[model samples]
Target: MNKKRIPLPWTNVYGLARTLVALGTAGTLAASSAETLFRPVATIGDYPSCNSTTAASLFCLSPDDYSHLTWLKWLCVAALLVIASGWRPRITALPHAYINYSVFSGIAIADGGDQIALILSTLFVLPALGDRRRWHWEQPQEQTPETRATRLLALIGISGLITLRLQMVVVYLQAAVAKLPHAEWQDGTAMWYWGSNLDFGPAPWLDTVVGPVITSALGVALMTWLPLVIEGSLVVSPLLPQWLRWWAMGAGLLFHLSIALMMGLWSFALAMAGGIMVLCLPLGSTIRLRADEDVATVDTSPSQEAEPPDPDRSAPSVEQPQPSR
Candidate 1:
């Protein structure tokens, strides 16, 4: 009997799926970290947590609500690592990738606003697609190139981490800038307002420690001017002195962590964790490519060289030039 062939629509349907996954990874990692860190995690005796007034439904995420978020965050990171190792990520990743990206479709679809979940989906899309130019209609069983896997993995290393840092900078900067318009933020009153908020149980004393007068002024300062300074520095991180940039990075984490503790924005904490990617950025390629990182190569062949090339072919090939004849 002759085998009947099946047709594949690589574009529109399948292509879109891939794009969504890339964006989802970035957005999920970034947003989840922020959401998890800034907002409290699921707990007893509370309505669901929502991060934005724009999506109040989002605010009501349960312990289960955040399940997909954290799961996707780590899963993407893991997929990136495995892909970089060229361990045939397609075999294991497609399943996890689908789950990592797709679960939130309903939530995003249900609650509209240019698809926030889509943001994460878009971020992760490039890493997952392997080689868009190389894509061809084929069965899932078709062998995936190790080069494609490796390159994609490398992209995850670069883009995933970089995107997270950018997101962190954006988050803090946006918060800081938004504070600028608010009279309270300018005078540091917003900080006090946050400190004074009683609903953030088990921590009423934390925000209120400062007398109301100081609270009011600090609130304005934090809500207003601080964002300008943070965002300004964020713009300059690339050009700023390495030491200062590093300190800014540290201050960012500490400041956010403090917010998490006092304001109880647990998702924000998680977002900060995602931003942990920034710390890794300073390390030279030696460390990041895992050359300095001692671990078993994906290919454990004893004869194969463990050291990657100076320009590792195994690393993600952003745009491969045709080899010179």
Candidate 2:
């Protein structure tokens, strides 16, 4: 049997989603390492490090022990970078997920984005165990049982991506719903309070420009109601045409980008961006064959090729010419 190359684009989609989740988690952890590692509130020395909490943590050392925590953090970062770069993803995925789970476990408070990203990290491990082939560029041989299993694994991984997109839409819709009863969200004045705060708002220089604008009725509505509308729209975005779905995802991306730039929530932005990639890629669609493969098909049965061609009987018969003519 001749081996055929199958172009399964969802494999690439899954791979990209995996990379984004891994890299986004790594970046978020790296950004918040100081607090996660040694903060007074949730350091490795915290009372619940080993005994009280049900959550699993990598930082099980005594609060006084700083040396081991430092080494472990750096090692986790290294492993994350390797996963993000797509160099030896199968080997690094376990460590990436473990370290992230442990860190979040030890922390006093965890962001919803980070929690979801950690879950996605664990999900990628299943796909990594099956085949070491790179999904973004090439796929393994097709039609073999092993290849089919690998494809199944890849589908499982892509399902994780789909789950992430659904999770994001749910989160957004939930937020919007929660705000429905609040007068601030309804009157479009919520941005005024949020934008005026020094902790969550833009830096002093930028706030000077952004503050006044948000205080106005139109600006407030734009900032507050726009998100609600966008979030509601995203709930149905997956059902839209692929191009339109991408446009909706792009809008979500812009919303997150604005939050990152204006509100200084980089982790949330990155996590949302990762979810966007899952929807942007062609995850649910079937693969298309190359032009050369379009006209080529394998005949699995010898009898199929040996079958006689059908005769046509619909045409009119021509008159025979006489010998004298």
Q: What TM-score, over all chains together, does every model reach?
A: 0.44, 0.74
Q: Report model 2's TM-score to 2 decimal places.
A: 0.74
Candidate 2 residue-wise lDDT, 1-325, digit = tens? 4332222223444555666766666666566554454555623455225655533566664354666666666666777777776665567668867866775675555677667677767766755665466533233333335357656665565455567667767777787799999998988988888998878889887887887889787878888888888787677776664446656767888998888789777766776676666654344232223344457431110111111211220111211111110
Best by lDDT: 2
Global CA lDDT computed for model 1: 0.40
TM-score, predicted candidate 1 vs. hidden true structure: 0.44
Residue 290 of model 1 has an lDDT of 23
Q: Which ten residues in a row have the lowest lDDT in candidate 1?
A: 298-307
lDDT of 1 at 141: 23
